[model samples]
Target: MSRTSVPPRRARTALLAAGALVLAGLGAVSVMQSPASAAGLQCSVGYSVNDWGGGFTANVSVTNAGTTAIDGWALTYAYSGNQTLTSGWSANWTQSGKNVTVTNLDWNKTLAPGGSTSFGGNFNYSGTNTAPTAFAVNGTPCNGGTSTGSPTPTPTDSTSPSPSPSTSTPPATGDLVDNPYVGAGVYVDPEWSAKAAAEPSGTKISNQPTAVWLDRIAAINGANGSMGLRAHLDEAVKQAAGKPLVVQLVIYDLPGRDCSALASNGELGPTDIDRYEHEYIDPIATILSDPAYKDLRIVNTIEPDSLPNLVTNVSPRPTATPACDVMKANGNYVTGVGYALAHLGGVGNVYNYLDAGHHGWIGWDDNFAPTAQLMHQAATTSGATVDDVQGVIANTANYGATTEPYFTIDDTVNGTSVRQSKWVDWNRYVDEQTYAQAFRTAMVTAGFNSSVGALIDTSRNGWGGANRPTGPAAKTTLDGYVDGSRTDRRFHLGNWCNQSGAGIGERPKAAPAVGIDAYVWVKPPGQSDGASSAIANDEGKGFDRMCDPTYTGNVRNGNSMSGALPNAPLAGHWFSAQFQELLKNAYPAL
Candidate 1:
């Protein structure tokens, strides 16, 4: 990536607008380099670059050489050549002319003596790429040294989290707990935080933890240049800092993935089951099982929009797609997801939460029971069982509100049921929380353990702003009542792209309600669902009409306006305007 290159985007990462939970691993490259720093706030910085002619990827490993624990540090270096930064991970990256600033993320900020943490970035240049002559940490000039027998650099997940531990959270050791996040620090992605902090009001929510989407195989290793599955996990352990830490990884990328949509299409073909299992899921599972991460609580959001598509996007349904039909006939989604669940679930520290469709997609009577059955089928097949699954996640990367304060499905106006309203559209549920709770109950009935939990993705569903409804909509008409009383502002319930006026939903919290393990921002705000129009790229993503604001109705959206914002980038790429709007309208306002 060059200085002028756009940032990588993957908000819901692999949910909705296109992909869901994916994982990858970036192999380390050994390079000859001099390290710096020996005491005080000093650090030894190792810079390793993987160049490809016009562009190059660089890894910077910072080893704390100080006697006392070096907590909260910033690394700085000057590029000897014209190296423009495009994107980065493992830390926050920023450049001003030739100088680059790398700040430790919440996870990597604390470096005990003799310990090392790493971050990397992508750069573009025309001439020779010369490594910087000097580097510094926390304003102290770094001295030359090499990572050697450092006891503190790579500590287990038992390390205390940096920047002050919260007194409210219960402390934890290296074992499983009822709710991993109950007294733990969730990972704040340095990559996404860098993007957020770049915005005018980005700092408001930049540090909030969001799921790191490893959508494609390439992403598993590194997207934009740094942070593969191993890199992310390694950072998570560091962030754990002797306390329980939760690292959310989206386990997306099934063969013939997202059959019902084009924007988040994956690299695997419809029948690439073997590749999905061996190359993708198996490798991720192996990485997660690495003994180093045994102390971290790893939460994997199983394939989203996969099983539900099998339930609702197949034959007989007017919303069905030929691709969906092919997917169903092939039976890959079920197998792939089942295999993923089986393998990842084997990891000691991993907790698996399958993705259930949002309230709008599977809340209907005809779709509910069947979808739950489909989920049950997956959970029990391919060596997986109910015990392998901790729970299910709902409305992932979707704009479904957690709740509707003004009305219920049972409410009536002039003898017309709320389900009769255009917005409710015959669906049995009014909002995500109700849908999730009922779905949880149905899951138990469908054979999941009674203790199974549910996760609600509250990112971008708040719909708060001046336009937010003050109370139930006018009951003069059923349609008006449903429309006015709702918190979700989408033109249609099926609108899943970069919807206009969408705002950040509930800030993530654990055990927010009964049966609900957490309210999460699985879909990080400010990332585009898909391209606004057809654009070409190698990322395997296609342009779906749903992402084009000007495109007219799709069966999924009830033929309404697409409800997307304009000029969106491909799915997972940063959407500046959308981020700005998210801040402008954040609920419990920023």
Candidate 2:
């Protein structure tokens, strides 16, 4: 999809306050134009007048009508009655009472074989009139009979034959990936600040639409009830005013002590979790149901890590089922999640990507493919189909760069290094690209080509290549491991409180290559879960071990981490310098 232009001219203050409504209202105008025919080549004009109440801003679209290319052209016609042209674009417009002419804009001088372009103008007219006469292209007169009177008469039963149908081709659908991501995730104030600081220039975090995760919203204001912050959050969201930003949500509360049932995080008890589900997740889902949020896109994980851990780790150990009868089943969890996502109505612009654990977390033979099948079966059994679930995401948090990492059950005993290993693979070795390819290929190998693909977390990997050793040994390790299978699936980079320069990577090689699918700051960088202290893990210090209050670009052993903080005024200067250096490695313009 082409990136639509932002509104013409408006004050920053007014834009933040009423931009959404203004943009929506602007949608009523006829800004879109299409060729009269699709097969060969066709050109037609569309006009829209943006009257700031008094004058009008006229927008126009010009389409190509032939299969072969044309370099330059001019449009001319007689404007009989009271129409007077003021200004225009895509081409320059000039008029003298009854005569008008339009010349192509320098940048749009060429009308590619079957392509089209649009131009706009501001006009002052007392009333509508008969259409123009003597339409000509490149000084050659079109065959349409010229009009002599006020009301433009249609060319009826003339000797000139109608132009043949167009034969040009259209662009691909996946091109939709080119549209820019225009929203942000805010779970906490500090998280919001860090995010604001990381955005690039020409974009402002305050203007971008934002979504506040319900879990984070509840945890911030010392509220015992889930609805306590509803009004507060709505206000905070509006504070950015209206600049086309939107909110995203995830409903994590569910009843039942069954791990697979819903909302059963290993940390929370069954009863309390159920209440939080009913009071918190449910009401928020209701707020999302509002028509205002119809365009919202969300990743509804009733409980993330619900599947991978439940089937592989949680079900087997610790719980220790006495017999087959006592063992818990995966049906409730899978089915419940499906029902929740479909029924979680009212939210706008939402898309759900279920969780698929990291490549290092599970074994090759451990039935990764079957996991998708099981989820599908559960969803279908509960009347949900593959379509209900968008896709899946592979996550690696807490495990970070560590291998024997799954649980930190003993933070009091020994903070960072205490965890159990459930599989032979290490969960922290795969880089963004490697992990992306791993999950994509695995899904395909498991025959999920039609059903599932993967997304990777670039939240932590700052180094170019995987931290793991490379060479013959690395190739040997990957010999039997699938690496590039699910190339068709969405490849989003999951970052937390995204800093501008951090987590940047080489663009993907595919037609719409994967660098950052949505650039989702999934973890919302700044918030602490109360598990680790600032002293022991220093979350306040931000990136590396720089010990700075906020992370920004600074050189360390010939390596630079610039532009990591977008909103930081002091930090922006340093970031700008580093990006200039980085761009030196970019592809030269032809």
Candidate 3:
């Protein structure tokens, strides 16, 4: 399905301040401590502002200092100057004359003792920008308000019956992996740091170093070997200091990397499968298993777009490329992944999540089962057990909706059932949730560990506001009307390189739904998916036609589509324009 393009609206991009600051023109600032508290419920607000001439971006963090947890929270403050809110994130922001109020979202309403959640905003001012002085939480004054009365005590019912003992089993301890990279202690890549500095005052893309992509064995042995993996691990361990330090690593440099596409070609030839195991996988395993870093929890996302290509792109025809023939003959894709899993799985602290191609790819009838079987084979091959894999990740480095609001498992689209559609056919019928659940069931039934979980990369799937549809149109045969009227539809499945209308999906959350472990930003926000055009680089990847905005290429169903996104930089490089667009169109309206 296709739709006529609607130009993205231009507005002040909002940013959430739960972590490192990337305010325009401002260097990294330490978290500001709240002033001395008043006597009532002890709530502190940390305020930070990044000023750029007549405009500035601000982030406020609310900390629960009281002994009890509050079910919901609201904060009110008045700007000292003529500041007007342009946009905000992580909460509902509103203004009454000079006073501005921020309310918590449903998922973040509960504020536990010592726990904190933050909200940010961009604003324009006439003359001066001054931080708000007065702050109140839950109708109580803060930063020095006198107690109005004794603290409210926990409530108890007067005439209620006694509760019965529970028969439910408690969830497994440490079952939920703590993504250390989520809030404050995440690693910051030097490249991201530069990007943030360069584009301060612009829409801040989450350039925080989230993962280290190892594309070649030489990256492990060079002077900056392991692509600074060890240094980041050391930093994470030190920052964690006995706490669970979760570090994400991407094992991407396979021989014939991205076999179906040219954008992410790796250095290794198809014949280097043995070298991949000994030089790349083995050394990474050694680093992870080191006794010093034993406490570190490693969340390894094994190659993106690798296994899926093997299933969909490799051909049985005699005309298949030499690389494809070699890859299939040597079992490089499956065996290489199996070797990494086997080696890494041996480490007690390591948790592996195999990439299940996004809903757009694996949602198809033909792709889902085969992908699951492939994951099962790879996980169990080379001495690796299904236990080596914790779950299958969907929508990795792809733009797929988190939920298809218009359709359910029983729904049909274009005369095809949602559950029975193919990648080329039902690109819009299913979402990540439906696809992940079905894929999980398929993998488990295919001999994978039954306890395997599912993850979705929500870093950039937020298609919000006017771009988001309310429902399918009635009495419409036009592809534009069909595609345009769908509530959760993306711009185009044919274009994956920094999709123009894509926005930030749901924020990182733990176990948001059944069979789902977490909604993670596996692909760090703001990093280029691939170069806009082919350029020479040591990373062993080439330019993909999809990254070129002008190229007319073959899309699904013999349709033709353009491969270009006008302003996107090369994959892995930072693009400010895309970052701004993501924030502006953030799902849930930021």
Candidate 4:
């Protein structure tokens, strides 16, 4: 999402005779083209690095200016003579000294008529502008020159754009960095709670949830603090190479909570709420309420699906009138939660997105509208004129699961999954575009506008939404089921949670839509839902290794029943991993 808005690359002032693509004006053959001909294809290759883990990623676009589609082509270029390809994809290559020959694979082959192809790779560096020489296509020289040897496009010694501060840098006010737990909102057990408490704290204000949780976050720059959640997350992200990861977390315990049925700290409801208010929530409110905390960006959920489930269950009670009808009664619950934070005085510090269950999870009419109204009423109850919450988030933890994907136009699920007769009223999963449109439309109808919006979990959507077909092979590749008999070889590393197969383009456009506030990752990747390998089915230890490493795109140690951070399962320790994954997903170009 951090894209550079600089002007497009211009033709190198100094052109080379060799790397130049000469259009013969002949049939089909436009001429010999060079990699430099493509936008962003720097005549010289080097990155403006911000830190060890973050830097500019090189995108080498090789357009087949030639009329015919080339089945396969190779890119041969020299780095600054010191830079190395950290990792690459879409093509393969062998490096010999300064000359690296990159060959396109079957999937990357075939440049269509008047069509162009682009292949990119990244390198790990920590400084600025180091140019290389002699780029070629399949051994043919490129740059701004001809096939015969010529001086490569000479890069001007002019200053290149400076890189932004690395996320490794400590959190400062007004920073809009991604929360590692960006997309995580799901059911987490008490074990995580116990583990989180037991984990050592690096900050003096350990009582403060923000301080305690983010103590290790700053260490992402390198090893800046005691090894805690961030360390494990860093390891997992590194293991993922450069792929984007989405981690999900469900904060079930709110203490003094009404939805205790869905979750309990195992502590008394009122007493637990006491601890949460003073020890956890209050302290978090204090820090985040500060202008400093507001400067720092992270996704914070006021509560999970408790409100929706409560309304769905209690709204029908004979005594209940239209829930959000008046702030005096039904709105009190939501306002009470908002009041505690509003009292903290950190407006806009946290992105408070309430829960809007998946289309399959709740109804659009009574359920969705009433919930949104409660948010408005809660703001009124607190005597706060501004909307306290951002927007409603749907599909909290249910990514990759076929049971539910996005909001439905019609109430097909009707708050239950048991009926086998329910058919999807419409089929929109044609592409990412369609999927995104459905999500936007559904939320808009549900009253999510510029001031409010939704967040989708992209993790586990890499394969089609539904579980892969039955059989061994089905269970072994990117599409294989997580619990199927097939070995763990099915999931994709970067896109495991992104159901791009739904044929929907990116949803909730980068900019906020009218009435839609911010659509961000509410669920980050890597946290487990208590299924350890030691448990019943393979589902047990599901938290074990992020998917079996035997699987194609695995990220962590599958053998360790213990989750990624601070060794074995720690209550809130998984949050650390989720946070770190969100950072990687958000700042991949870094």
Candidate 5:
């Protein structure tokens, strides 16, 4: 559940004249439009396209020019050449014949004066792909021409005001837009590709799902340009061509990472906070901020397993080490996270989600409030507002079921009376959905914008029929029978490293719940959490007793189970056996 590797690491248009051109070619053509005159409103549209041989990607921006605001608006346009719509984002796109219309989603319906919103579409094209010519907003033409309507009269101030200096303050509400950058494409890691290719055809791991992880060890080692952060990015961009590149980067490598567990030990020491900022964070930020990557939509999960430990396991847990105290005393966790939030958060297209750990870690009352306060303070210290972050991510690299079928946290089962046990306390009784919603409410109450969304790591929380019980057993006892009967229970809450009997959870989806933004595979399915024991390797990960099947779980580490996983590889490395198991036991029978 912790990482320690390190390495590596836009639009448009104008009234066709004053706006800048972003990309030019068959691959992408983007133009920004200047203000056009409409009687009651002045509006402009910026258009951009990403072309890939038979198909292309297009994004359009609608800007309001006049001083008055509109509650709703619709855009209408027609393709000039042989182009057909495939899919679109941020708006509802529909076509009849050659014309296409885009309407706003519920969240993005309102626009303030001088405000703008962007939508993108993927299209199929033939030999020639020409930009659309005519565009209209709410029936008003945006062809760099004036509209016919009676203009609103300007009002004059009655009283003279004394001259004084004005100070700019942050907006009362943060940006309400969901992760604006969109495309279905995910950046496939070259290493993962190689691994998959090496496997024989028809093998389970030959087509396993994989993701890219940026940890502390890789960053520190890769900073000097020897190991290739830029190279990986360049390759991903090339593979994406003109398509949207969805890259997942874990901004880990804090000084005292994994304070509660030693399996995923990081290379960086607690006192080396400055090195983390310069050698680690700054270089990665520079690579991502590079102009060549303006089209790539980066999803950064900042400091998984780092922040929540500062709340729950830092002080009270006996298994916690001095590293936690050092992190707290020197403000390493907050400052490092804040640095990441400010530096990467400023990137125009990057969507940063600070890790809120799993529901098991922060779902309790004692841990929830403090975690929110920590996140708020981190944002402030980093010189970034809550607006800079997209939202909070829970269950980043943990195995927690998305839902529990038989039980609810309300202490009732099928309308029958049921008593909640101490182990299944109010906090522990919830699933990822309930946990995320409650956490979102708590975070917004702690001063985050109401628009802030939630994300869950559904990579491996699917407990399929094999592990689940056939029928409800006696609920009389809390120890052996209750734990055995519960379908959603984990072998041990603290056992995170290469958990046994785990299955691939829900597939990636967007807006799965009320406050949730997306159900993402933050942790790649096949990658090992850590090795069974310390083995000398270039990956810079160490061994822990937790991954060994022989090592009985203990109360000190909060792992009170019998069996630990056996034969797992180092953290972030490919484990073919584990991959096969995941595929065989996949939830929804993937």
Candidate 6:
């Protein structure tokens, strides 16, 4: 339920030039038609981007300046560089070399004069990513010149922004359109890849990207004999091959980390906040800010299970532990986390996503709002503002379905609300996606930017296999229906170790859901969450009973039997059995 990891391309937009358009930094670079030319075309386009080295997401608003409704439109433009189209929303996008064309979707064909509609696409490129110089609307060879006020004009009564909010997929964050994952490839760790590939039929997901956990200070320089931070970045550079790529790093190792659980305790003690800031965070920041690795989009999943503990695992909550109480009293959790956010966030190419505990932990209304406030507090203190943090991540290193397709929180059976069911426990969310999206609103309400997005760790949350429910359960007792229909099959909602029946979740992908930046495999699938039995190591992980299959319940897990698999290795170590189980039970099935 807590503790784990965290982990744009602009391939999306070419506002064809025929009129005035808004390009954020370019300052009112509009797409305008000459007055003396054919009266057939008179409109404006707004182009904005979130670029990370080799790719970008282009968002454009095309406005009809003519008095009459301009029906059936297509916007055309040519990229000055070798930009290739990746994916787009609200338009039928096509590209040939530098020339790109975006035709309005059937739902968006009518461009009412004085009204504006927007569409965007993701793109990949090499060398300079120069803006397009020419644009034509609907076969009119019109001259596009600059004349614009704010980039986005107010939509008039007739302007239908194609792709209704209800009917179409939500788009990426525009204010921070420079999302690093949009058109970039994720950095695939050779270490994890080799282990996965060694398994039977493992090649299917071995090549996928996963985050590297720098759980200890030694990990920064390469713990044991593994790859160091710079070494990984160096390899990421090679893998980038002239295009933008992302390297995911978990900035863990805070003083008294994972206070509620024993499994992920860290090297620092409760009051060792100074060492955490200078020794751990500062060193990593120094390396990431180096210009050599600036081209790689470095994503830091700023300490999971840190600030959230101050809310759910401290005084007043039944789940509170003595360790959590100690850390809260000292206030070092906030200090360490705030320091990490400020230093790591200072790197221009780096995007820091603070970890929000999964829905199971904070979905209750009482816990939800306060958790967001704590996150904002951590972000603002220690020289960090909300802007310093890009967004948040949920279900890190934990199993929470990206969605529960079979049912929703609103479901009821025999006049009983699903929230009343024991499985739901009156919690507001039924799955990670709902909780994450709603938490995004909460974060903004708590004063983070409206542009702040969310990331869901889909690494082991798929919950698919033969036991996976095909549809909603038959109408019966509310508990029966909710339990039978749920995609997450945990014996109890609170279980959070190397759970049996867990499968690899959605493959790592970019800009997946509304308010979500990406679905990532931050906790590599095969890595054990903790030792099944008491084991000792120098990395600072402990053996929590939650990882013991034979152990009985805890207050956090409703006193149920621990559902973890037996004989698992230490946390963060590879467990072949776990990996194979994930492969076999994969939801979209391997």
- Which candidate number has the best TM-score? 1
Candidate 2's TM-score:
0.40
**What is the TM-score of each predicted model, taking all chains together?**
0.72, 0.40, 0.63, 0.37, 0.65, 0.71
Rank ordering of all candidates by TM-score, starting from the highest: 1, 6, 5, 3, 2, 4
Candidate 4 versus the native: TM-score? 0.37
Q: Lowest summed lDDT over 10 consecutive residues: which window, candidate 4?
A: 22-31
Summing lDDT over every window of 10 consecutive residues in candidate 6, give the lowest-scoring window: 163-172
RMSD for all candidates, in order, please: 13.6, 20.6, 21.7, 22.9, 17.1, 17.5
> How do the residues 122-160 of candidate 1 rate in per-residue lDDT, one tens digit apiece?
788898776565667887766443222211222212343
The candidate with the higher TM-score, 3 or 5, is: 5
Say which prediction, candidate 3 or candidate 4, comes out ahead on TM-score. 3
Candidate 3 positional error at 472, Å: 4.7
Poorly placed runs, candidate 4 (over 4 Å): 1-252, 256-276, 290-294, 315-335, 344-348, 364-366, 383-386, 400-450, 461-521, 531-590
lDDT of 4 by residue, 1-590 (tens): 22122121111121111222211112111122334443322232121122223323333445555445566677776655355565443357567665567786654476554444433344544444343435655554444543334333333223642112111111223322233233332212222334434544312111112211221112212123343322333333443344433222223334333331211112223333333333333323322332222223334555554565455545343323332223233333454455543433233334455555454334334454565555554444443333334445555543323223233223223343222222221222312223333454454454434333445533322333233333432223221222242111122212222211221112222333332333333333334322212233211112323322222322221222221222223222254443333323221111
Q: How many pairs of residues collide in model 1?
A: 33
Best by lDDT: 6
lDDT of 6 by residue, 498-531 (tens): 9999898999888877777899999998999999
Clashes of each: 33, 46, 11, 79, 23, 31
lDDT of each: 0.76, 0.35, 0.64, 0.35, 0.65, 0.77
- What's model 4's lDDT at 121? 46
Sort order, lDDT high to low: 6, 1, 5, 3, 2, 4
Judged by lDDT relative to the true structure, which candidate is superior, 3 or 5? 5
lDDT of 2 by residue, 492-517 (tens): 22112223322222221111234223
